[model samples]
Target chain A: MPLNDQLPALNREFIAHFGEMGSRWGINRTVGQIYALLFLSPKPLCADEIAESLEFSRSNVSMGLKELQAWRLVRLRHVPGDRREYFGAPDDVWEIFRVLAEERRRREVEPTLTMLRSALQETPATDDERHAQERMRQMHEFISRLMIWFDDVQKLAPETAVQLMSMGSMVTRVLEAKDRLTGRNTKKQSSPS
Target chain B: MPLNDQLPALNREFIAHFGEMGSRWGINRTVGQIYALLFLSPKPLCADEIAESLEFSRSNVSMGLKELQAWRLVRLRHVPGDRREYFGAPDDVWEIFRVLAEERRRREVEPTLTMLRSALQETPATDDERHAQERMRQMHEFISRLMIWFDDVQKLAPETAVQLMSMGSMVTRVLEAKDRLTGRNTKKQSSPS
Candidate 1:
């Protein structure tokens, strides 16, 4: 089937959006497009199939698939009587979200924390360095605490996670109400209970 | 103060990680470092201060500042008696989060939604397009509903928002449990709400 005839408007739109989002997330345009294809595909698609369907170079598809695997975004399947592998997205979007958050925290946040820890060890003789280190300490501690909570939230029931992610829009309002109700405007001192 | 003396380990780590994350998030290395600096600084820093302190090129600093302003990541301030403009980040991280979320939704999600809407207007007559469109409808509806929930989450109480963000690691475990308990294995029937 002709590519255009096979991919409806909705699919095209999805592909385009995913492509753009990929760029925002620091991935290449083609990487995003391939992911979108896998996401919308009902059955597993091989590298060649994806390349041919998307009209992208086989090497590009190969590279994108490798990165996707690194990110744990795609899974491989073997068709009976066939040696080649195919790819598919996980069944749950929440799972994808989990992988994304975890991967980012690991890749971006955790390493930074390590560096901050070592930096905090150095003594400061001057007020400027002292002040700067103070700021760094706050950030390190704050991010660390937040990471702990993320670990905890990940353990919550799936319904709870959905409720929380859905709470994205309502977050500020909730904070405001909590402020008025508790008279605590700064960070919460919620200790382990 | 000399840059070496002023840059704490934490700050250095932040700069390094932000530089790496910048590429992932579609921003430049220097730009991310600059934002990291702004984020931790108690007072606004001038272009010269930023340039001298971070050791980035003047032109790069200029471009980075322009981009930061466009993102609303920093605000301009003038000393009561001075003409030099200082740039500062919002004190509240939640505010920063709000801005980032809204901006990303606009830049990434909204455009995709627009594309999907336009694509949905076309009819899917063939099996391939029919399958593709069906998947597209599912994804489009999912993303749309998810964004609505995000808007709601944005308005959530600040403390609640922090509490939610703080969930960290627990986020994954809880959702997994919910998946098993509810037997919500399939994507078709699960409403994000």
Candidate 2:
């Protein structure tokens, strides 16, 4: 194969793998491929260019772009001296991560939280129903706490979040040091052992 | 509706909602429904019981159980004097979360890390390829750091993790306090501004 042929082949491999990975994360293959293409492109690409390069139908590309836009994963740009609308992924990977986390929380987590709250409002009239309600309460509390923490983390500057993440388990050491200074009982430490 | 009828109706609604939610997370509807059913059950349930309760075919229940087991989201138990296999979710919701995180890390994250590592090994033949390679490296590093942090958190006792999560943004405040004590420059605070 020519060098040019090899390059597209390699790009195709990456695109295909991304599509498969996206399916595992509840995204369809086409959208994943489109996002992968945009992410790897050196410049913004118009719909026609994307359709031609990926050999997707023009309509398919249009719909995929719409989906990507709804997810806030792709941005629209207009090139100088060009009338066509072009699409590209954000240059910063951390921005993409932040958008994904925020969108998923909005679309998936919030609805479940609503459901749990409504379920908990009902009075249980039987032993079985009471048991189920209790389970739901436990689930509700767990999800609520997680979302609270997530919301706080989302508020952090991406760089700060990165710093905290890079600290890894060392954050635990810091927490321990604070506890020692305050003379707080670290009873929970017993559970990990 | 009769009281008995009303109870099952409510349970069914929760199960159906969970199935939908599961699909959004890349789990098939049947597996999600099965797991939800088991999670709410006060006792371990046999395959026949599961099939009858969910009104699914026996084979469907079997396949769902297999998938759930592979995900490590469900466990098998043998009842006294019974030949049939019974299934149940972990009694503790946190334990379920731990299993899911570990299994996904093994099945999904590890493979992607391997791919990124191999992709990085090949020298880029052009400027565009080099830029793409650079983006790939950024993605790889971000994912690796995340996995490291997750691994550390996972090692913490569930109680400790809960405590940490409940602290929410207070943890960030703690970090800032530590920074002041150590005189570290917090340049990233401007990003969120």
Task: Report per-candidate DockQ.
Answer: 0.30, 0.37
Q: Tell me the tens digit of each residue's lDDT in model 2 across B26-143.
A: 8998889999888888888999888888778889999999999999888899888999999988877777777888889887898888888888887887887887778788778888
Can you tell me the CAPRI class of model 1? acceptable
List candidate 1 segments past 4 Å from native: A1-6, A159-192, B1-10, B158-193
The lDDT of each candidate is: 0.70, 0.75
**How does each model score on TM-score?**
0.78, 0.88
- Candidate 2's displacement at residue A110, Å, is 0.6
TM-score, structure 2 vs. true: 0.88
Q: Name the 10 consecutive residues with the lowest summed lDDT in model 1 chain A.
A: A168-177
